[model samples]
Target: MNHFQTGRVSTNKNYFLMFLGRKGDSMIEQEIQGASVAWFKIAELIARREREKALGVCRLLAHSFPDRAYELQLEGDILWALEDTLAKDRYTQAAQLYEHNERWVEAIALYEHITTIYPIDYTALADLLFCYAMGNAYDLFTTLCNTLLHKTQTGMLSDTNYTTIMHQAQEKLQKYPTSQHTAWVNDFILWAATK
Candidate 1:
């Protein structure tokens, strides 16, 4: 279950809130500290092109904290990098596999990683929002939508670009509507339509 379902909001000092409730106090503390350390180690490993070690850390983080978006995103990034390292141009094919296979969770994770590195990338942002909606990650989707809308209002995002992305998002929503999160998608589209 997620934080809302458990009725416990995280109080971790880290920017990425942890979901270590089931691990007990001592273990939770140890895991949190380990996660912090692993984050830096994972970055170093990725920079060094040490794919196996980075993948190990990422997989551990993802399995230990399934609710942590950052961990999932990192796993997706590491997997993408590994694929690209092994094959010259298979990353795109892998992404398409995730999308076609209805693995919205993995797709969202990859897009989240991409968005963090390229905040102003409209295409990635649009896909990220769509995947979030598909996976019922409403909170992340709403937060990103607000950020993009703010950028558009401030002229940081061109009108054409904003419209194009929003239109693409709408098409995705319509094409593969989910019963659960589609309400939020509709609400978002209505708001965007008015704007």
Candidate 2:
């Protein structure tokens, strides 16, 4: 039985509204309509191993909100649990959506996984570097900068892109200095400027 049917809680929306007393009517409505509750329900079903139900909810959510990255991610999660190869593509699509929204941290988390499987993916590597720099993850940025520098020297990374990335990295270093990497960055900047 449902919580309300079991006499453990009221079915009245007012009962829940009491907890959000200061949130106002519109806020409460928005919170409900925003799919936070539905997402939680689906997450609970997934946790309980109700795989079919969770997949159904995921498909419904993705269909209802085609532009929502989280919905696509949720659908991908369900598909991944079912061992579907297309799940990876779904994840990439969701990551692209995050990138378009300029949500660097989220995009980086996904790109990091994708790049591990496709290490020579320069496009993903480049975007991942940008996200690292944007998030002030200086240590990761330093590592990626060195990798790009190596690639540039080996003619793997394009000269034009390398110059652009090096300049961006130099500006990032100046904007958010890292104590341990300072000398390395300085040397790279000098090398990059000369090239």
Candidate 3:
């Protein structure tokens, strides 16, 4: 059978074994092992640019093991791969996938994920900060800004550019005076300014 069919069969067998309270069933164990092998095979297909086959296998695995961390991670990896190979608009689809999975932190992280391989990633940083603020994760927001400030001090970031971005974010925060969340953002900006 194809990887997708194998995954589905394994998933059904696993559920049946669970319902029967038969934890030591060799048949079920083998099926689970088969599913894991299929999952890896799908990952290989993805790496080989077999997009349709990879997606089919990944979809089956995702449905079969909705709460499995490895499965979720693989799905995210697949989406990221598609994002790289396709247009920028593909990122929106990946973002939606994270949202559908209710992986809010991952979704936000994806929206703002960055690498220093490039000169600067101000847009990613800004989106990350905004995501933290919008989620009311004040502690995280503070920690992120503090880390960025430290990086700037260590010369990892260009001081002039960092300052300019901070100033703009602060200005934007000031415009929403009535929002407690904005107040928190303003407080963080002020604290960063003093340091």
Per-residue alpha-carbon lDDT of candidate 1 for residues 125-150, written as tens digits (9 for 90 to 100): 77777788877787888897787778
Q: Write the per-residue lDDT of candidate 2 for residues 58-127, one digit (tens) a residue.
A: 7776765657777667777776666667667777888879977978788889878767766765566656
Q: Which ten residues in a row have the lowest lDDT in candidate 2?
A: 175-184
Per-residue CA lDDT of candidate 3, range 15-44, in tens?
666677878579667878878888788879
lDDT values, one for every candidate: 0.67, 0.70, 0.63
Ranking by TM-score: 3, 1, 2
TM-score of each candidate structure, all chains considered together: 0.51, 0.49, 0.52
**lDDT value, candidate 2, whole model:** 0.70
Clash totals in order: 0, 0, 0
- Candidate of highest TM-score: 3
Name the runs in model 1 displaced over 4 angstroms.
1-92, 177-183, 193-195
Model 3 bad stretches (over 4 Å): 1-41, 47-76, 79-93, 96-104, 111-119, 164-178
> Which scores higher on lDDT, 1 or 3?
1
